[model samples]
Target: MKTFVKIMLAATIVLVAGLWFSNSFKALNNQADALEQPTEVIEQPIIEKTKIEPVKKTPFSETIVVETAIKFEAPLYWAVNDYGLIDGYSSTEELIEKYYLEFTEEQLARLFTEDFFYNEADGVHVTASASPNLIQTDRDFTITELNENQYQVSQVLYTLDDGETAYIFVDYIYDEVNNNWNIAMINYQY
Candidate 1:
């Protein structure tokens, strides 16, 4: 009789636990439904507006695209090869690259810009008994390098094609937006 009573008690406990779990699950379901179905937000409206303007458009055929070919983007330059090196070996190549990257054609013109510095040391003399003509000397200079601090160049006064050459130096200032080197002053002609 005692064994029967113990079995009955165990069965009752199991049934009660199952019922409680089912009712708890139902209560959770009720909460989810109540949260999902909102009690407000009755209506919304639809409206439209359009505005137009006129402008001239150029034809695609006539459009020209000019892209600057920066062989090396500086700092960590030549990291990803955008411009292929033809033979991959250049000694004077660096100087040539500097000219394109550091100076514009317009900036190059400024080197030849004529304005007397008035300060005797900075001005030029055309005729001197012991010296070569400064005008002819300048005409001989060919652009070799454009740098953030200086312009490295060559001056060949005697021979146009094959002459004794001297490096012409121009002082420079660096431009940030253009990332360019500009002539600040022609400090030395060496």
Candidate 2:
């Protein structure tokens, strides 16, 4: 019985020592792995390519209404008639001065181009005048942009005496130096 007891004690001590040594070996391996240098991982920046679009220009067109009897229509009618009759004033300068309140010098010059007038005798005759019976109603004018710097204003008028329709087309060009719009052309039919 005594020899049996001593043999059992020796077996238990060996089992415990074996388990302790195994656990110590695992801990040492984990510490070594933690102390080692880590692998380098370089990250590249992400670049996204986007498409750029150009700005598009849009043309302008609109209908306008001048709410008055004939005040707005008188100046244009008088100018066109005087231009056709060639009896308003002597020269372009005189015409521009006379209508300076209505139009600018640059505008008058463009309306009466150099080819339209000749060096003739100076006359002091006023031959063209606006009729008292002419009337302008709502939506009587349409303004359209021909290009980036050019525009056309078309007007329609009616005669109270005979109920006749009249048409007027005026072209305007933007002058960058003068910072204003000048009359490029005028055409009318009564």
Candidate 3:
């Protein structure tokens, strides 16, 4: 009786495992069959295509215009006293203080060559001189390229007090060592 009971218990466990495996296998087979089946194709409505015309090609010409204005960075004038005399000072600081000029010594120095200012028998004087108030109303500038590093700018100036018209030419030369352009010379013609 004991042997028979043990055999029955083993058989019941085997039967339950077999049923579980059979159900799992059947579910996997059903999924594979569904994947192998072809998908449904829905019909789409067709519309007529419109014809596109070819664009006509035209000859194109590109024109470029460039305008540049040259500016004088420093004042090109000599300091004068109340008595209408060219005032000479011992140093730039003294000249600025006496004339109430806006330029610093360094800025004034940059406007000319290294030896622009020198002491004479009477007093210190500059090589180039012009008054800003004398510049004409038109202020038209004619720029000429002298060389690769030199440029000459010519303009007409008018004096209000004397009613004088003069043509002023300023030459600028590029300083290679300093990598800047400095006023090399200035000339005037009536």
Candidate 4:
């Protein structure tokens, strides 16, 4: 009776293991079949290309041609008094000889206008320093034409070792009689 009981217990365990293995195998096969099945593909929409037209010009539109000339820079200079200080220039003649050599007669006359200087008799008075030092060697200047008879001259002056900048703006008007550029106005950046 004892041997029969032991054999019955071992048989029950083997039967349970066989059923579990069979169920696991069936589940694995079902998963494989789901992956192997065919799927429906969706189609993409087609796009059409459009042609571009060139822009047309109207008869009222007129293109003006501008002629740009080479830009020339006037040399940087200091206005010093008779004692070699930056107080006031010695005389109008000295000022003209040093700085206004390129200026036309009309331009020179414009310099004496009542609004041009603080002291007309003294000419240019710069009481800032004894003398201006050149901070950089290269400088840039531009002259643009506002119209056929007028031009604008602009220059940037970097002076002294302290990196100071002085801007000079001058307007030149073309004299039909002389056919040359004449200074109409002169301003400093301060």
Top TM-score: which candidate number?
Answer: 2
Best by lDDT: 2
Provide the global lDDT of candidate 1 against the true structure: 0.39
Error of 1 at 15 (Å): 48
Pairs of residues at least 3 apart in sequence or in different chains that clash in candidate 3: none
lDDT of 2: 0.54
Winner of 2 and 4 under TM-score: 2
- TM-score list, all predictions: 0.22, 0.34, 0.32, 0.31
- Give per-residue CA lDDT, model 1, range 1-190, as digits (tens): 9999999999999999999999999999999999999778778676666666543332111011011112211211321233322222232233234433354444433332212101122222112123222313214344433533344433443433455444434344445555544334433332
Model 4, span 34-85: residue lDDT tens: 8899967889887878888544322110011011111111211243444223
Residue-pair clashes per prediction, in order, are 0, 0, 0, 0
TM-score of model 2 relative to the true fold? 0.34
Task: Give the per-residue lDDT of model 2 (tens digit) for 45-126.
Answer: 9888888864443233342223222333343444334434345766656655664323333554434434343434653333
Ranking by lDDT: 2, 3, 4, 1
